[model samples]
Target chain A: MTLVLFVQHLANGLITGGLYALVAIGLSLIYGVLRIINFAHGEIFAVGAYVGFFLWRVLGVPLPLAFVGAMVGTAAMGVAAERLVFRPLRFADPLNSMISAIGLSFLLQNLILQVGGAEPRRLDPFMSGVLLVGPIALPLQYLFILGLAGVLIAAIEVYLRRAWNGLALRASSQDLGTAALMGVSIDRLARVTFAAASALAAAAGVLVGSVFLLQPTMGVSMAAKCFVVVILGGVGNLPGAIVGGLVLGVAESLAVAYVSTALRDVVAFVVLIVALLFRPQGLLRGA
Target chain B: MLALDRVTAVYTGRAVLHEVSLRVAPGEIVAMIGANGSGKSTTLKVITGGLRPVGGQVLLDGEPLEALAPEAVVGRGIALVPEGRRVFPRLTVVENLRIGAYSRADRNRYREDAARVFELFPVLAQRARQEAGTLSGGEQQMLAIGRALMARPRWLLLDEPSLGLAPKVIDVVWDAIQKINADGLAVLLVEQKAFAALQLAARAYVLENGRIVAEGPSATLAADPRVKQAYLSF
Candidate 1:
C-alpha cells in the first residue's frame, strides 16, 4: 500500500479512536467508583445521539447547542439510573446490577425504536470539505472530532487532578470506607459520577452522529467496542481507557484498511478475547 | 458528650455488640481496650453510622446520631481514623488532607487545620506531593491521623493506631495523640495494646465478647488483678 493510503487510514483511525476513548472513559469512571459495569452505558450514548438529533432536526437549534443539550439530557438520564437502579442495588449482588443495566439497555433501545421509528436518520455534518497537507487529505469533520475529543479528554484529566469533587472521586475509588470517614458524601458523589459518565457518553454520541448514521442500534456495536477498550485499558482505569480506546480504534482501522472492512467490528471481539486471556489485570495499573 | 447508650450492633445474622454503653465527655481521653473480635471496631462503625444499630441511641451532645451518614457524623464534630491506615494510596498527601475538610461548613478553617496537621506530622509536609502508597507504613499511619485532623474535629476516634508498626513509630503516634488531646479535643482511643492505651487516657473501658466487662479510671483498671491476668498478659 502507498504511504498516502496508510496515512489516510491512520487519520481515520484517530477519528474513530477519539470517539471510543470518550465512551470508555465514562465506563471507566462509573466502574472505578461504584465497581459496577453499566451495561446500559451504550444505550446512554444512543440517548445522546437522539437528543442531539431531536434538538437540531426537530427544534432547529444550532449544532453546537444541540451537542450541549444532548450532554445535559444524558446526564439527567445517568442520574436517574443511579438513583433508581444502581443506588438501591449498591449493597446487592453485582450480578443483579449488571442484569438491571441490561434491562435498561433493552428498554432505551426499544424506546428509541418506538419514538424515532426503525428507519435510520442522518445528522448533517457541521463542516464540509477536507484539510489537505502534502499527500494527506483529512476530512474537516474528522479533524473536528479529533480536536474536540482532545479538548474533552484534557478537561477530564485536569478536573480529576485539580478539582475537589474529582479528587473525592479518585479517593473513593481507592478506599470507599476511608472516603466516608473523611466526610465524603458517598451517595452524592455516586450520583455526580453517574451524571458525569452519562454526559461523556452523550458527547461521544453527538460527535459520532455528526459524521455517521444516527441509528437506534448503533450504540450496541459501539458499546461492545468500548467494553473492549475498557478491558484493554484495565477495568476502572481512566488513562488505560484512553490508551485502550485508541489502540482498538487503530487496530480496527488497520483491519479495515489492510484486512477487510467487514472485520472492523470483529476486531474488537478478537482483542477482547486476547486481552482477557493474556492480561486480565488490564494494560494499566489503576484497577 | 459523645455517647453510645445501650448500643447494639449486628453483623450478618449474628449480634456482634449487645447493649454496650460507653461515653466520652468533652475534651476527655477515653480508651477502649479489647481482644480481637470484641466489637471494638463495631462500636466505631455504629458511632460513624457505617452500621445501623438494631437498638440504642448514639448521641452527640444529646442530639440523636442514628441513621446519619458518616459525613454527617464528621459535621457533628466526630471523626474516625480507621484501622489499617487507609490513606487513599493513589492520591497525593495533600489531596488526602483536602478530602478530610470536604464536609466542613466553615470553609475558612481548612488552611488553618491543614497547617496544624503538617505541624503534627512534619514528615507529611515533606512528602506533600507524593502519592500515599509510596510512603512507608509509619508515614501512612501518620497521614491517616493527619488526614482526620484536617477536619478540625472536636472528638477524634482512633481504631488500633498501633496495628503493624514498630515501637518507635507507635511512640511518635502516641505522642501526637497526647498533643492532640492536650489541645482540648476528646479522643476515644481503641487498642489491643493496653500498656499504651492505659498510659495515655484518664479513663479506660475493657470490651469482651461485645460487652463492657470493667471500666474505671486508667490507674484503677491498670492495677486490677483480672485486667492484669487476662488483657495485659498479652
Candidate 2:
C-alpha cells in the first residue's frame, strides 16, 4: 500500500477504535463496580439504533435530536434493566448474574427482531462532505465520530475525576462495603453507571448505524469485538479499554489493508488470545 | 449514641454473633476485645448495616435502624473503618478522604473536614496527592481512620485498627484514636490487641465464641483474671 493509503487506513482504524472504546468503556465500568459482565450490552446498542431510526424516520425529528433521543432512551432502558434484572441478582454468585445477563441479551435480541423484522436498516448521516489533507481523503462522518468520541470520553474522565457522584462510583468500584460506610449509595451508583454505560453504547450505535447498517444480530459481533477490547485493555481499567480498542481497531485495519479483507474479523480474537497469554492482568493492571 | 441490642448475625446460615448486645453513649469510647473468629468484626458489621442481624435490634439515638442499608447508617452519622485498612488503593489520599464525605448534604464542609483529617494525620497530608496503596501499613491505617472521620460521623466503628502494624506505629495510631475520642466523637473499637484497646477505651466487652463473656470498665477488665489469661499476654 502507498503511504497515503496506509495513513488513510490508520485514520479509519483510529476512528473505529474510538467507537469500540466507547462501547467497551461502558462494559468495563459496569463490570468494575457491579462485577457482572453485561451480556446484553450490545443489544442495548441495537436498541439505541432503532430508537434513532424511529425518531428520525417516523417522528421526522432531525438527526442530531434523534441521536440525543436514542442515547436518552437507551439510558432509560439501562436503568430499568439494572432495577428489574441486575439489582435482584446483586448478591448471587457472579456466574448467576452473568448467566442472567446472557438470558437478557437473548430476550432483547429476539424482541427487537420480532418488532423491527430481520431486515437491516440504515440511519441518515448527521452531516455530509469530506476533507482532503494532501494525499489523504478523510470522510466528514468519520471525523465527526472521532471528535464526538473524544469529547465524550474526555467528559467522562473529567466527571470521574471531579464530580461527586463520579467519585462515589469510583469509590464503590474499589470497595463497596467501605464506600457504603462512607455514605456512597451502592444502589444509586449502580443506576448511574448503567445509565452512563448505556448512553455511550447508544452513541456508538447511532454513529455506526449512520455509517454502516443496523440489524438485530449487529450487537452480537459488536459485543464480541468490545469484549475483546475490554479483555485486551484490562477487565476493570477504563484507560485500558480505550487503548485496547484502538489497538484492536488498528490491528484489524492494518490486516485488511496490508493482507486480506477476509482476515479483518479474525484480528480481534487473535489479539485477545495473545494478550491473555502474555498479560492475563490485561494491558493495564486493574482490580 | 449507637446500640446493638441482643443482635444475632449469621454468615451462610451459621451464626457469627449470637445475642450480642453493646452500646456506646455520646462521645464514649467502647472497646470490644476478642480472639480471632470470635465475632468482634461481626458485631461491627451489624452496627454498620453490613450484615443484617437475624435477631434483635440496632438503634441509633434510640431510633431503630431496621433494614437500613450501610449508606443510610452513615447518613445517621456512623462510619466503619473496616479491617485491613481497605482504602481505595488506586485513589489519591485526598480522593479517598473526599469519598468519605460522599453522603454529606453540605458539600462546603468537605474542605474543612479534610483539613481536620490532615491535621490529625500530618503524614496523610504529606502524601495527599499520592495513591493510597503506596502508603505503608501504618499510614494506610491512618488513612482508613481519616477517611471515616471525613464522614463527620457521630460514632466511628473501627475494626482492628492496629492489625499488622509495628509496635511503634501502633502507638501512633492509638494516640490518634484517643485524640479523636477527646474531640467528643464516640468510638466502637474492635480489636484482637486486647491490652492496648483496653488501655485506650473507657468501657470494654470481651467476646468468645460469638457470646459476650465479660463486660465492665477497662481498668476492671484489665485486672480480671480471665481477661488477662486469654488476652493480655505481653
Q: In angstroms, how far off is B157's CA in candidate 2? A: 1.6
**Chain B TM (all candidates):** 0.97, 0.97
Expressed as tens digits, the lDDT of each residue in B1-234 for candidate 1 is: 999999988999899999999999989999999899999999998999899999999999999998898778888888889999899989889888888888787744677877888999999999999999999999999999988888888999999999999999999999999999999999999999997899999999999999999999999999999998888986
Residue B108 CA displacement from its true place in model 2, Å: 4.8
DockQ of every candidate structure: 0.83, 0.83
lDDT of 1 by residue, A1-287 (tens): 39999999988988899999999999999999999899999999999999999999999999999999999989998999899988999999999999999999999999999988888887888788989988788889899889999999999999998777888899999989888878788888898898888888999998888888889998899888999999899888899999899989888999999999999889999988998898888888544
Cand. 1 TM to true fold: 0.97
Question: Per-candidate TM vs. native?
Answer: 0.97, 0.96
Candidate 2 C-alpha lDDT tens digits along A182-230 = 8778889999999999999999999999999989988998899999999
- Candidate 2 chain A, which ten residues in sequence have the lowest lDDT sum? A177-186
**Per-residue lDDT value at A41 in model 1:** 94
Regions of model 1 farther than 4 Å from truth: B107-109
B94-210: candidate 2 lDDT, tens digit per residue:
999998888888864788999999998999999999999999999999999998888888898899999999999999999999999999899999999899999899999999999
